[model samples]
Structures are given as C-alpha cells and as structure tokens.
Target: MGMMKRLTAALAVATVLGGGLVAANAQEVVLRSADTHPDGYPTVEAVKFMSDVLKKETDGRISIQVFDSHQLGEEKETIEQTKFGVIDLNRVNFAPMNGIVPATIVPCMPYIFTSKENMRSVMDGPIGEDILKAFEPAGYVGLAVYDSGARSFYNSKHPIKTLEDLKGLKFRVIQSDLFVDMVNALGANATPMAYGEVYSGLQTGLIDGAENNWPSYESSKHFEVAKYYSLDQHSQCPEVLMMSKVSWDKLSPEDQTAVRDAAKQSVTKMRELWDAQEEKSRKIVEAAGVEINEVDPAPFVKAMDPIYEKYADTPELKDLVKRIRDTQK
Candidate 1:
C-alpha cells in the first residue's frame, strides 16, 4: 500500500470513530477514475457503465466519478498518480506499462497477437488471469482487460506497402523501449512522445506519422493530418482497468467483490462499442479521403523475430509467449 493510500484509509476510519464498524461499512464512497480518451470513447463510456453497475451492486453506497480526456493527466502521468492513490482508477494501454510490469511486455510485442479475436481469447482465459495477477506486486489490482482492436501504421507520407517504404521515416511511438525498438526494427526512426502530443507532432512535421487502432486515429483527428494508413495490423495489445492498491484496501471485502465484478461485466459493453467504433471510424476516414491500404503481413512478421528474441529471453516470458501463441485462434 502507498503512503497516500494508508493515510486516506486512516482518515476515513478516524472520521467515524464513535460510530463503530457498521458505520464504516455503510459509509458512502466515490472513487475517482482517470482516462486519457475523451468522453463517448469506448473505454471512457465502459468505465461509466461500470460505475452504474457498482452503484446498483452497492446500493448506491459506492460509485465512480470519471475524469476523461486527460482531465487528470496523460497516461504516463496518471499511471503514477494511480499507483500512489492520487487517482483511484485508471484505464491504460500495455505499452506505457511495459517498463514497470514484465507481464505487460509480452502482449505489447509486435505481431504477437494474430488477430483481435485471438487476443481477446488469450486475455480472457487463465493466461490473462495470470497477467492480471502480475499487477498486484507492482502496486495495482488489475480488474479486466479490454480490446484495443488492431494497430496499424499511418503517416503523413506515402502508403507503406513494403518494408522498404518505411526506411528512414520518422514515427511517433508510446513511451516504451519495446515500442521504440519495434519501430526502429521495421526500418524507421522512433520518436517517443505522449498520445496527446502526437497530433501537433504530426501537423508541425515533428513526426511523419504514428501507429494506432482505427478508432484512435479517427478520434484523435490524426487521420486529418496523416493521409496514408497502412493496415499492417502489427500489434493487438489490450487496454487494462486497474485500481490503486491503496484505494482498494480502503474498501470492504464485499465492496471489493462488487468492484471486480462490475469491472468484469463492463468488458462486454466495451467490446461492443469498440467493434462499432472501429467500423464507424474506418468509414469516416475513408470518406474523408484517407488512403488506406492492406500490406502483406508476412514481411512485417519476419521483421519481428529479433524483437521477440531480445525481449522474451527469460524462461518466464518465453513460456508466456509460447502459451499465447499456442492459444486457439
């Protein structure tokens, strides 16, 4: 538990000193959740839906107040805030978490997940449960994993039909060494930048392009500047909903169960919204004259061999990668 979390729990208990244990259990608690994505985004809306479930489950005693669109901070900044209990909950991609959590690196690797369906299957099973458990020792209680669809390369320059087209091109990537290495391996120069900064980076020519799912490219309005979108579909890393251990410790066991259950149930809503959002964004971008192309994934997959070898060196990671590969598609 973090110092802030401990202090928060202590303060809550102190306020009802004379009321006994029942009063503490009955105390109304509202947790603060953070998301970089704007309102109506699937991840944001899903958390909102979870809040509704939690309120119903707890008889309105427990609720969540979401702060979306970087209202709190960017992903990297909010992650630290969540850890220290400055933020109660967070929804973040696995890339930003790679350096801090080893298990997250496995899923963030390029070409590791064959398709969205496969990725979801792997993450919703025992393997996913194991990965979720990995968060606890690192200061989070992972609740559920949500879909990010498939990520493809999009740029302001020409369509990347072949590996040769990407050579020497500069691209913005999330703040992760694996992401940097992955971009560099594909024959491009990787510029580490925040998600919020990518739009300006693209418009100002600070970067040639970036990689992300269709919805993100559309929602962030990056598609307006980056006209070429190549469907390499390189990565299918999932998004995670996590609670600060400090905030978690403050909840009674029953309330904790309610939170977990509600979070799990929210995945259904997220996936439905995500599927619809992907289709809608694709249509909008296509209508806007964004050149979208499908590339031969064979060459891209071949390029990732060295990346896999470098990152999945440990026996634990090797086993995890193998299990994910062996999972039924």
Candidate 2:
C-alpha cells in the first residue's frame, strides 16, 4: 500500500510538471554511416570519433554504426543511399558533391587554395558554412569537411622538372572533366581510370604517371613502382561528411543540436589526424627511396588559366572563387 501510494504521488507530480515531466526511459536512435576509405584512414578515424562523441553527448540515446571500405557501397552509391534515407551519414569526396550541390565546385576547382592553411581557413569560416548550407536543397546536411591534401604529380618513367617534361606523358586522372581538362591543359595525355586499377596500370606500363597526395601515393604503394614524386600540389579536393535530411528531420530538437555539436568537434579531431598522417606517409615514402622533388608551381598555375576561364560556371561560382583566391591565411 505504501508503494502504491508513492506511485500515485509520483504520477500526480509528473502531471503537474506538464512538458517538463521527466521520464525514466528515453527513445534510442541508431544512425548508420558509410565511408569509402579503409580503416585507419583519417576520414574513417574522424567518423569513429564522431560516433563516440554522439553517443556521449546524447547520453547513449544515439549511436552511429560506421561502414568503411565500400562495405555499404562506393561513394556515389552511398550518397544516393543517404539522400534516400537508407544511410544516415556519409564520408565522401567533395568533388562529387558538386553534382548535387553546385556551390561545392568552388572548393573543388584546381589550384584555388594557395595552401592547406589557406584552404582550412576558408573551410572553417563563414564561406565554408555557406557551402555546407547549400546542401539543404539537395536533401542533405553537410556536417564537416576534411583534409584530402593537395594532389601532386608522380611517375615511374621520368622526373617532371619543367613544363616540357609533362608533355607526351600519359597520365591517369580521376574520371572528372575538370581533372581531365587540367591534365590536357598541362600538356599531358589524361587517361581516365578507376583508382583500384591504378597500380596495375602503372605496373603494366599502361600509364606513365598519376597525381595524388602523399598519403594516397604511399598508402596505395604507388610510390614503390613510381619512384619520382613531384610536389606540384595542384589540387586541394576536400572530403565531406553529410547526413540525410530525412534522417536529420527524424532527430529530436535536442538530438539535432547534439549531432551538430558532435560534428563540429570531430572536425578538430580530423585536422590533427590528417596532418600527422600526411607527414608520416611522406616520411615512409621518402625512406622507401622515393625521389621527391619540388617544382616551381608558376608554370603549372599558368597552365590552368584556360581551365579557370572555362570553370567560372556562374556569377556565384566566379565570386566564390574570387573570395577564395583573395583570402589570405
């Protein structure tokens, strides 16, 4: 009878508290995320950190399950899955996001950012926020951007000491028109190929060279066959973390805040991991006897003038590029 009386009293107190009523149990939410990179990649690590932070901030009410290495699907497939609400979150390259959110092209444009510091400054500021916000109309919410490092030219045949050396060399490039055009503008024959086939392509002498960041070159073991690495640092293609609008809308207001805050915190964690990974990869590649070279980027910059003229896709895009170029770190 005393227990019954206490239960009744507690019910009466809860009714009086109205919307402020406390419940003994809360709903649990599980979010599914996907990353194309392998485990231990900086982007994968960032997602893992985000998962931990979300669980902590939401008091275990929310948990994220991350699928890496195309376990769910390739980047483009996973993007569509996120949009359809099948995947709650995604880690993908920003270049493809331009197809859904055209404003992202500003960041994907070749040689736009003067350096990584310059790029991060723009990305971590209002401009980056604006770009992320642009995803809303496409049924996506951008959570954060991550480092992909600037891509540089590397090859097995010869060293690219000057602009002339780039001519007549067949190079493998990402299957993007911008990258293809950039390679052609640089006086090389651009052969579009899938990333997985690059090693065989280099090994079999199908292609003479490729362009990518240090971590990719080293991690992919492209440096083993391709001994010459020229640090032209041509493009700074960033990675993006995104959530489906459908999934986001399902989150409670408080949970929404928690997710956004967790994403913000994860960005800081990724920057550190990415920088350290790049340095470590560079050291490993150099110690492996990769002949690294630094070339004057002026000629390479001039080579892309035509590409810029062609890529100024809109007044908005042109203005965004101008803002990025004018931004000083």
Candidate 3:
C-alpha cells in the first residue's frame, strides 16, 4: 500500500483511451499482478485485460504490471508472498487456496458444478460474496473468480475409459492435499509435482500422465507425449484473483472501488476468452494426434463420494457444498 502512494505524484496523465493517455492530471499507482500461465493463457489474458480496465476505469490513476509464466516464483510461494504483502496480486487456482480459506474448496470439489451457468450463479452471487469475505481473514482480498474450464486426465500409458483404467497410473497433480486425496480415491498414484517439472516427469516415465484443462495440455505440449486425454471432467477449479490484504488496506476508498470493479469486470471477459481458448486448444491437440476420450461421469462421481465426505471436515465447508449445489441461475 505504501508502494502505491509514492507513485501518485508521477502519473499526472489524462483519460485513458485507445490504450493511450488522454487528458486530466491524476496520481499514478502501479500495482503488480502475477500468473503462472504463459502470456496467452486465459488467466494471464484476463490479468492483462484487468490491467487495461484498471487504467481506463481509474482515468489513468492506477495501472497493473503482470508477471506471467512463473516469472516471480511457483504458485504456492507467490501465494504466501501475496499473503504477507510482498506480492500485490496473484491469479491462482482455488485448489491450493483451500488451506488458507476453507470456503474456496467448496466450489472446487470434484463434480460440484453441473455447468458453467451453474458455476456463474454460485460464483457471482451470494456464495461468491461469502467466500470473498472469507478470504479477508486469511490476509487476502478475493477480487474475482476466473474460469479454469474442466480438468481431464491425459496419460502416456493408456486411455481412461473407466475407474479401473485409472488404477496404477501415476498422475501429476497440484501439491494440494485435496487433489492428492481425490487422485488416491480414484485408485491412482497421485504424483504431486511442480507444473514446470511435469513434462520431464511424463517423458522420463516418472509420472504416467497429468490432469488439466485443454489449453494447458496443448500449451505445455504435454499432448505430444501423453497422447490420450480422457474427458473425466472431474473438477472445474476456478482461478482466483487475489490482492494482498496489506495492499487492499493501503488503497484509498476510491482506488479500492476501481480495482475491485476492474477485477469483477474482467471475469466476464475472461470467460469469453476461456471458452474460445478451450475450443482452440482442444482442436489443436486433436490435430496434433492426441486421442481425446470421454467417460461417463457417474462412476467417477460415485468414486469421489468418500473424498467429498472427507472434505466436509468443517461446518463451513459442509454448508458451502450444500449452498453451491442448491444455487440456481
């Protein structure tokens, strides 16, 4: 927050238009945003769009600089830094955030959302507001939730057509206890590895495969080695736009409104970009010769029952699941 105050004098620029500065003199406040995906990935694109929106919405008084492709550090480390006020902003999956804010894990549960519409209803309404508030106690200010699409499994060994097909396969997962539990519940060896290490792990047979959205499978070029992508559609883990509480507290009320509004507006744009990217990435991977398969989610859902029960370790999480399932568009 102190950082932004020092720049207020330097940015006496005008209205922002056509990606250019126009009229009036305003204080310039530049904040940093971070993402692990490459430049074009939907989450990163959303961050860039949010930066633009922030500049324009605030009349060039505020701007954001984004770091993509893990330029600063891995997800967990940067997440902690954001908590401590070292990092101003972070775009990360809700899966890892469950530990710091339990309400986040409710929507991230496997098979939780019936459709994107259903998800939007939950994330943009009361439930979303509740979770965002829940984040306040954890040293984070939840700005918005971005679509992550669905995470399906792809492997070098074989196609996952059924629950039995998943057994004995080594799959890379985020270093989250919930994900580890979910993978193990499916009878697979959950290999928790860093995102950058996944390719080599798959190539060297250290891991048989991994689960992720279409863009990731194509962008990371994992499809080249792991030729079989199973559409288990296990979870729609949304990405969270988080600002450090320290930074949030530092902002003037007007600046806070600008940043928060910009973040929320970016969600609509991000989803549009995400849908197109998912389709494009899927087609690209298929043309690259990756065999994409679909599975009846019933068995997979049934298999996840225990994990769901395990997840209801607290009253808040239990109520969260019920509310999300009950939410309607």
Task: Give the winner by TM-score.
Answer: 2
Clash pairs for candidate 3? 14-23, 15-23
In the order shown, what is each candidate's alpha-carbon RMSD? 4.4, 10.6, 6.2
**Stretches of candidate 2 above 4 Å error?**
1-26
Clashing pairs in 1: none
lDDT of 1 at 313: 84
- Clashes within 3 Å, all models in order: 0, 0, 2
lDDT of 1 by residue, 139-159 (tens): 999999998889899999899
TM-scores for all candidates: the values are: 0.85, 0.89, 0.84
Residue 237 of model 1: what lDDT? 85
lDDT of 2 by residue, 29-137 (tens): 7677889888888888888898899888877778777879887667777777678676788999998887789888878887788889899999999889999899999
lDDT of 1 at 235: 88
Better of 2 and 3 by lDDT: 2
Please provide, for model 3 over 187-289, each residue's C-alpha lDDT reduced to its tens digit, 9 standing for 90 to 100. Answer: 9999999999999999999999999988889989999889999998888878799998987887889889989999998898899998998889989998998
lDDT of each: 0.87, 0.84, 0.83
